[model samples]
Target: MSDMYKAPQAELTNGEEHGDFGSVEKGIAGDYSFSISETVSEGWRLSKGKKRTVWLGILLYVIALIAITVVAGFITGVFTAEGDASFTQELIYNLITTIIGFPLAAGMTMIGIKIARGEDTSGTEVLAYFDKIVPLVIVNFLMAIFIFIGLLLLVLPGIYLMVAYLFAIPLVVDQNLGPWQALEASRKAVTKRWFSFLGFLILLLLIGLAGFLAVLIGMIWALPLLFIAIGVAYRKVFGSPHRA
Candidate 1:
């Protein structure tokens, strides 16, 4: 495995440099302005020749999700006599899926990062972040709780947070931050241009909707485009791993 794929041995300090990649702290504090057109175009450019690998990764990810749901449903079914799981059982099922899902989600983010950085991917990159599974799960769990609470209080805070923590998983995978650290870092960095990020997400959602309308097979293309775009955004927010 390359250094890019490996987790950092030491916790990143504020403004600490990561070799030729530059300081993430600097990137965070620097200009948050980025053109969605350029970002999406760059993503499309990087994704051009890697369609097969990207599609395969998405397919595998979907399969894994279905498998997890099926297994969870089976286990929860054993405890239910009415053919419907109780609230507790449903919650348990969701918890099981969420715990198992985050690492895979991180892997997907890593795959995006890899594409953004022009690194090679084997499609099996979807399975690669199990090493960081603990932090991934914890960060996601905390994010879910916070977002839920925010939603209960007022709708806007939850919406704000939904956009604010976009880079949390990437932070964990790329910068090797702990759970809380990753969440905070993502929130703070994205807070600078929260509306812009929201616009970016809206644009991505539009793209996804367009893809879904195209018989869903277009998602193989759209999903990769979205991830690569997100990867581009991640690199834009943090610093790029490669030297310019």
Candidate 2:
């Protein structure tokens, strides 16, 4: 554990770590304040030098994704070899892929969480969600629908919801939460410092973009940092009552 990753005393607007204040409505953040620098630094500390494991995990995840897509495509080709596949058939195939692939996404989160917790794990741990696939699939499906609707109605709301629910998958992976419980916990945890967390997300995107610019191979490292940063945020928000 680096000094930077050490839990610092929570700073309030009044400069008090803990105090009895009345129901005074804070301006941007409510009870909790988020520091973008602290969060990103913590993520880097967790991610640095762990690229080999993260890379292996990501490679396995990609292989699984490609395998699933190819299998689905092959199945569709086999069934529709006599004629062009119907639009309905294509839609159903896509739905099937989404359901199967979404749980794999949770597996990556599980790996990142384990790494952030300093636990030694194998890349194959990315398949840990197979035992608890149902809840993750349901959660991913509902999140997709909600996010899509929010995007359709207003762009800002969709982005806000996306950042707010950022920890939902990790919560499901680490805490074994059901679909709704994970989402609700994420919302409650992020709602207090939504804007700050949104800034943190933007910075991470920029970092990833920089990696993509570095001949694209840099993504293997950059993506892991992003995921680890997410794990850091998860721990900050929900790890223990002391941090909470």
Candidate 3:
């Protein structure tokens, strides 16, 4: 989960190795040589499989969810009380909704990274990750903004943009990069994959549907596992330490 364990690609001038696990098994194309499932599980195994972190992650997440829901509900109630509203009013509300809980989204990114790395990050630690990941956070926000703008044009194009940038979070979390760099790398990473990475997207969308159908209980089990697998992917694509 933590990208600290990769095997070296080439030694650095100071003798430290560049973060890379050579020859992954489940690499997207011929580029990567790694297995997604195995790396994530390895991360979970390292985290000690404790229930405590899951509980905390879930609690923080739910609280964030409730806060946003309450805010949206209040806004909706206000609009209804005032009678019919303009499309512009509704549109403004929607954008407000998107911006409201950026902190929480950022938190999830950190928690997912920690969970994958088998680390014990308190909620405080999540905050710490955010501090360290400010570049990532800002880049991520800007990217989302770009996607939202694209969505304002045509819906399908927006969806395409979303998928293209899906790897931004993990890229930043694992690599500690700026937004542009992360986006650049992610674009390359996604493009160099099996069936254009559409299969991966479809699988995740299905998993999301299943998680929704299960009343989110499935996510408690699923999130950690997914992170682990991605952690493995990180290792495989990027190299060891990140590698399982």
Assess every candidate by TM-score.
0.81, 0.80, 0.59
- The residue-by-residue lDDT of candidate 3 on 154-177, one tens digit each, is 786576667667666656655656
Of the candidates numbered 2 and 3, which has the greater lDDT value?
2
Best-to-worst ranking by lDDT: 1, 2, 3
Ranking by TM-score: 1, 2, 3
What is the TM-score (0 to 1) of candidate 3?
A: 0.59
Q: Please, what are the lDDT tens digits per residue for candidate 2 over residues 120-149?
A: 565777777777778878788778888888
Per-candidate RMSD, Å:
6.3, 6.9, 7.5
List lDDT for all candidates, in order.
0.75, 0.69, 0.54
Q: Candidate 3 lDDT (Cα, whole model)?
A: 0.54
Give the C-alpha miss distance for residue 98 in model 3, angstroms: 1.3
Quote the lDDT for 227 in model 3. 44
Q: Model 1, 1-244: lDDT tens per residue?
A: 2334432333122113323233368556755456688788878876766667677777778899989988987787734546666888888888888788887777877887777665566578998887888888888878889999989887889999999889888788778888888888888888887887899999999999999999998887898899888887876778553433
Better of 1 and 2 by lDDT: 1
lDDT of 1 at 84: 63
By lDDT, the best candidate is 1
